[model samples]
Target: MTASLEAKAGIRRHAPAASRHAYVTLVTNDDYARGATALTHSLRHSGTQADIIVLHTPALGEASREALAALGCRLVEADLLPLSDAFNARHARRALHGAAPFTKGRKPDFHTPLDNFVKLRLWQLVEYESCIFVDADAIVLKNIDRLFAYPEFSAAPNVYESLRDFQRLNSGVFVARPALATFAAMQERLDVADAFWPRTDQTFLQTFFPQWHGLPVTFNMLQYVWFTMPDLWDWKSIQVLHFQYEKPWETNHPKSEVLMPLIALWQAFHDGGPIPDIAALPGPSGPAAALSPSAGA
Candidate 1:
């Protein structure tokens, strides 16, 4: 059977099963493939009993697929949502970036705004009773199996800058219940005439589930918190470390110097090197620390 059909059947066959939760992430290209690898490694390091699933688009390369499979991640090939041509054109990288430029930090060249929509496919994964979707650029620092018990639409508030930012939900890491009904409802509302989502899936999801449950920021800790709100930087408390704007894999990106320590942590996971005790890492310091509170104020 085809993937879509299999997904549908899996939902029917497995939805009623108890404790069938999975950790899901998306991989749109080779760069994110590398990120997903580190993420999966970290999940294993965290000793999670849940299954690891990598939902990848066709853009991901074979070598990257092999790496994820070798690490025991179940690969699910996901297709982009069939939105209108106008919607796709509007959200195309060039047009979207021109209209709403990212000024806070640099986004890597490999970033594609449109590809992010593929994350909606998570709702189609009805086979798993619950799934926690973590962005490929993030690494699990702690076993978050307890998140499966959180309600369907639980997510961390997008609180990198200030307390007010809590109004917005960050899609980087979230708990979801897989059901065909939810997926169908999303499709019906996703692509309307002149419809546009500035932040792609992140925007649509926040709108679709306006009353989304708030997961603690520790569950999806944005890297900016290191510098923007150093007081929130508690290694022991962070369950997931998200590299939001600039990726840790990039060489000499704009924020590279400030993010080096976190990048080093990611490298150790990616390179299969000796994993360091996160609590032992030095707390935030330097000019970056000086720039916060005001920026977030």
Candidate 2:
């Protein structure tokens, strides 16, 4: 059966609520395949018992699909045709002169084109009683069974603090329960707000939750040296370590040395060599001489 039909059958056979809180990831592009695999491996390695699913947009060609399938993951092809209007940044952000009643006091707006598709996937998958959304760029360092216990709309602080007034929360990780009313309100705000904030999904999310009730800073730790000094976080105690910037594929980031195991695995796959022992990674040297885009530092 096609993926859609299979998904429908599964949904009917086992209700989302029956599974309660599940964990899901969005990997809309083929380039993100390695990150997706690492995410799944790290999660299972740490003993997460929740359902794990990856949402794929049509752009992921056959090779990408096979690679993901080889990892024994469930895939859902997103309904991109219906979102054609929103898929294109220009049209989606065009100001509508004829204001729809629901858009009162709001202006024509859609978020930056980069990860709006991810926002859509989050909408579709979080219909369960609770759900945890983890960015494909993240790795699970520890078993965070306690994360599921956080209340709806819980997330860690965006270490960067780029947004004003509100402590910007990282969209990279969040724990949410079914809050149909809240989700609807947040979605509407995103669909019609004026183009004034950062062109990032995290900016939209920062506005979604009120300050006092937002999740504590301990949950989703954003790991970027430039955003804040890396030493600020108790790295050993973090629930999720997000490689939010200078990602592994980008080559020669100073912080890449810390995640050498992940970096080396990626290098082995690209070089067609035997996997190197994660422990014996060459002592952080000047960027590898033949720096391929795939060998991000």
Score each candidate by Cα lDDT. Answer: 0.85, 0.55
Clash tally for model 1: 0
Taking the tens digit of each residue's C-alpha lDDT, what string does model 1 give over 1-297? 454676543321212223389998989999999899899889999998888888888788999888888888888777677778899999999999888887777788999999998888888877788999999999999889999999979999998888999889999999999988998898899998888888889999999999999988999899999888889898888999999998988876666666778899999999877899998787786453344333432
Best candidate (score: lDDT): 1
Q: What is the lDDT of residue 228 in candidate 1?
A: 82
Q: Write the per-residue lDDT of candidate 2 for residues 236-288, one digit (tens) a residue.
A: 45556666654566544554545554465544444434534433443223243
Residue 190 in model 1: shift from native, Å?
Answer: 0.5
lDDT (Cα) of model 2? 0.55
Clashing pairs in model 2, backbone N/Cα/C closer than 3 A? 248-296, 249-296, 250-296, 251-296, 251-297, 252-297
How does model 2 score by TM-score?
A: 0.66
Model 2: per-residue Cα lDDT at residue 88 = 43
Q: Which candidate number would show the highest TM-score if scored against the true structure? A: 1
